[model samples]
Target: MIRTVVVAGALLLGIGVVAAQQDALKSAQAIMKANGKSLGGVLGPMNKGEKPYDQAAVNEALNTLDDTAKKLPTMFPESIKGMKAEGDYSPSSKIWEDKAGFTASIATFAKTVTDAKASVKDLNTLKAAFPAIGKSCGGCHETFRVKNS
Candidate 1:
């Protein structure tokens, strides 16, 4: 009976580690998504012609996005020392499930961000950048993120 209890405790601990990691990843993703939405809201007026594209405002938005992008790599759960595997609820498996496709999607995203950042000076150029930006996000969400859950 004591041995059985010990085994069960170990199993629970392992599962807890995995679950915690998943939670951390999910939290990071949520943070990024929230940041994106906030920036998008700020940029929308200029894009929609509701307000003139203010270079200062646009630059601010882009700077925020650049910061967000820089923080992205750290959020990924590549490794966590001392964390035990408890359970798993990540989209990592899906993200890498089709390795080639995933790589292409991420590459496209990076390129889109790079182009958008570089073209921040001109409203017309910024407008042009929107499609690529949206496409990059849509591609990842469709494949890696869970549907509406």
Candidate 2:
């Protein structure tokens, strides 16, 4: 009876770890998707506006982006380092092949937001900064991420 209880407890612990990782992964993806959508919406309206841009809104957006970048690394799949090389379980080869580039892309995005937080008080400054940040994100998507379609 004691041995059975011990085995059951171990199984539960293993499941708990996997479940926690999955929950974390899902939350991170949701955050990334929502943040991407928010950025797109801001850019679309800002580009077509003839009126002066809202500095407060731009700053708020930048703040959100900065937060996301800081949270990005923790979202990596828990099995990334231990997956079978020949199976469908390996981490993206691009990530391993160009680790420095991957890090740099995210770092650049974070820096853009940090700078934008300070420069967004002016419409012209924000106009310049916003496009630069968008380009960094686009660069990453072009090289590393695949589209769902």
Highest TM-score model number: 2
**lDDT score for residue 67 of model 1:** 62
lDDT per residue (tens digit) for residues 1-149 in model 1: 99999999999999998787867766665766655663467666678787788888777776666665555545555444223223232354554456667667666766767778887677887788766776776667678655332
Give the backbone clash total of model 2: 0
Please list the C-alpha lDDT of all candidates, in the order they appear.
0.65, 0.67
| Every candidate's CA RMSD | 5.7, 4.8
Off by over 4 Å in 2: 50-52, 80-93
TM-score of each: 0.66, 0.75
Q: In candidate 2, which residue pairs get closer than 3 Å at backbone N, Cα or C atoms, i.e. clash? A: none
How well does candidate 1 score on lDDT at residue 10? 99
User: Which digits, one per residue and each the tens of the lDDT, describe model 2 over residues 17-122?
Assistant: 8777666645755766666764776643674574446766666667778888897655565444332333122234465577788788888878877887776666
